[model samples]
Target: MACNITKLPLFRSISSRSFASAANPKPIGGVCDYEVENSTVNGVLVTSAENNSPITRVSIVYRAGSRQESSDNQGVSHVLRLCAGLTTKSASQFMITRNIQQVGASLHCTLDRETISYTLEGTRKAVEQVLPFLSTVATEHTFRPWEVADIVGRLRLELATRPPQFRTVDLLHKAAYRTGLGNSLFIAKYNIGKIGPETLQHFVNCNLTADKATVVGLGVDHKELTYIVEKIKFPELAGQPINPSPYKGGEIRCDKGGDLAYVAIAGEGAGHNNMKEAAACAVLQKIFGTGSSVPYALDHGMLRSSIKVTDSFAISGLNANYADTGLVGAMFVAPSNVAGQITENVVDILKNGKVTDEWVSKGKNQLKAAVLLASENGKSVVRKLGQTGALTGSGISPNQYINLVESVSTQDVNNVLQKLGRNLSISSFGNLTCVPYLADLK
Candidate 1:
């Protein structure tokens, strides 16, 4: 049963009750009571929200990512993000971890294709005390010589332990873009020794700038949070300025190891603001690749002998939609012998295109259910809000998402499929033995 926090008078009076109930109940679909304040920290866009709740979350998102790096600096952005937690002006990595544990908080950073986010979550009281430390790390981290060497050593260890096939994904991106937004992963086994303290420091200095930053805060009193934010100071942003842009699409393929061939075909689709098109693209993915209950199967009849083919592979398809551009693709991991046939069949399905009214309705319902489930947690809510605010400069309510999904129709799905069918970029990652068949997609 869904707990209606909005309907309860007790919850209305006690802000903490709303957070306590959020874990189990579906999120309330209305405007958040918190007020947002926007400012610039030496040109960085900082957004903060104040609420009466005890827990608070602070996130700093930057535009610098793997996509932004030049070929020579392919992995620098990722490396910088990882090293952000290691050394700060006020504390060492050990002290930061200890302090966070004592306060029941956590600090971490994540790097994606287009963005790097540093996040901290804890009690409001704790966060108020901790914000300065976080700011120092964000704005003034010092990459010591010893720490740089240690980080490189650890990265080398990871590369040695990981399988060769795993690296092919990075290679695929490198080949596809060939330039902007298509660089290699940081800390490759082949490149660890090449990176040193000077290069890492240069990377940090060049990429960590106000022009590329976005700060988001949730669950703290807005007035108090605003005060804290206003008091903090940052040096003037340096380096070349960055503006948001969409990723251009092109083919990228890699041949590595294993008896089976893995293929991922992708194309540019829609953005967050294009709700109808995004929903349509999702429905297109469901009808073509999602084997769940829809009973769609790969051409080679599951290819049981292939190592990459698991129960999960049968239902897998890529439906990643972003703020500026999106990727819609289908992948199949099948035996080397049948890999060509599977790719052809998958393409055939895309070309034949059968998006009926029933299929459209089912996809919409499934997508809505998934969104509802994801929005139930307070952390998830904050993350969603942060992404929306950062990417679109607007906040979306849960009800708005539901309404948008429900509004999609069969014609929209068919339209999306028709567009994807005509223009597509396919990528494959696997063995050299499987390379010949990949050219067939062209």
Candidate 2:
């Protein structure tokens, strides 16, 4: 599965990478230069990105996600995501929504395999106006039984509407990790009966802790945000320590029976701990490219340029980093007739593709541009801080990220490629009858 750094709540439609090749790139809107303050007050980790803007976004980020789930509690994180705007212990759902709407604030819930974030964005006054409610929602939500049932129904509808890419990526995760990271983000239809309000509440109570959580403020006064966080009461619960899940490379195939076949070819990638290799993998992703800039455009990227596929097929490189492990790979979407050819071609590129100096320079610039553009949003800036702190126990600023990308050489790219060898984790969905198997690719 592709690591989707752009699929967040705020960055959905923002295609910042398109301008990577600009001869003279202009500074993006919002504050690029800012100060970050990290503190541990009463055991709660508080981080704030002070910047100039009328809008303030406060996010409560937790280290608990699907990776933290076990077989008994699979899909609890997804349930918790659905329960974000539900009733808190001190307030009703109606009052929470009415008050937020009254103040013209926006509330969003976003989660991945390793993290979950609940954020509120609006004017400073609107933020302060609803701080108490937001606090309750994050730290003291009362998962009502009826509300759980309602959200579960909505989740089912969402699952129905999800495209082939979602399923394909999900299957890819399953192939790569086998468990933990392999667990699907969307709750399985059968697992719905297994999860309930109590299950979600237990998961939250056991996994959500001050040490494993960070309260981040963006485009807001640090002093004010710190004060607000200080005044709020949080349960003094300790989180359970999670053992790292081993990466067992394998394959998962599903025949959804569609004209288009989806395939993911992956290998082991750098974990969050290996910052250098992770940075190198990021450069490698840019070197190979992820999908076409425009629809139905081939030769728009290294992967597309190298893979001998017709216009009816598409290929892109994908990399996902986790706290303890990662996945580096490519995905292909093509008519079933040529799915095997496209899959084999992609694997061939990963195994023996050459990395030139020109590719390295271009990839470095593209990675640098992506880093700068991603920092444009205050929310993203703070999210990075929380994620870094949660995953790696440190934060990477925009300048630091640019420097890291700048230091990536052709040798580093080649080294990363060598590390991600031919022992690939493969997944194929949608008319898998025409897709190639792992052994068949060889």
lDDT of 2 by residue, 278-375 (tens): 88888888887865446766446688777666556767778888887788878878898888888888888888877899988888887888788888
lDDT of all predictions:
0.58, 0.75
Off by over 4 Å in 2: 1-29, 292-299
Winning candidate number (TM-score): 2
Per-residue lDDT of candidate 1, residues 1-442 (tens digit): 0000100000012232222322222224323443456655545566665444456677767656666666465566656765766766656767666666666776667666666677777765566545655666666668877776666765665556654344544544444445554555564555665666677767667766666667777765444444445545544457554434445545665666677677766556676778779877876665554545434644321122222433333324567566666666676666666666566666665655566676677677777766776654556666666666656665565667778878888888777767666656566676546444434664
The residue pairs found clashing in candidate 2 are: none
Candidate 1 clashes: the total is: 5
**Model 2 weakest 10-residue run by lDDT:** 2-11
> Residue 358 CA error for candidate 2 (Å)?
1.2
Model 1 stretches with alpha carbons more than 4 Å out? 1-55, 160-172, 238-253, 272-275, 289-315, 431-436
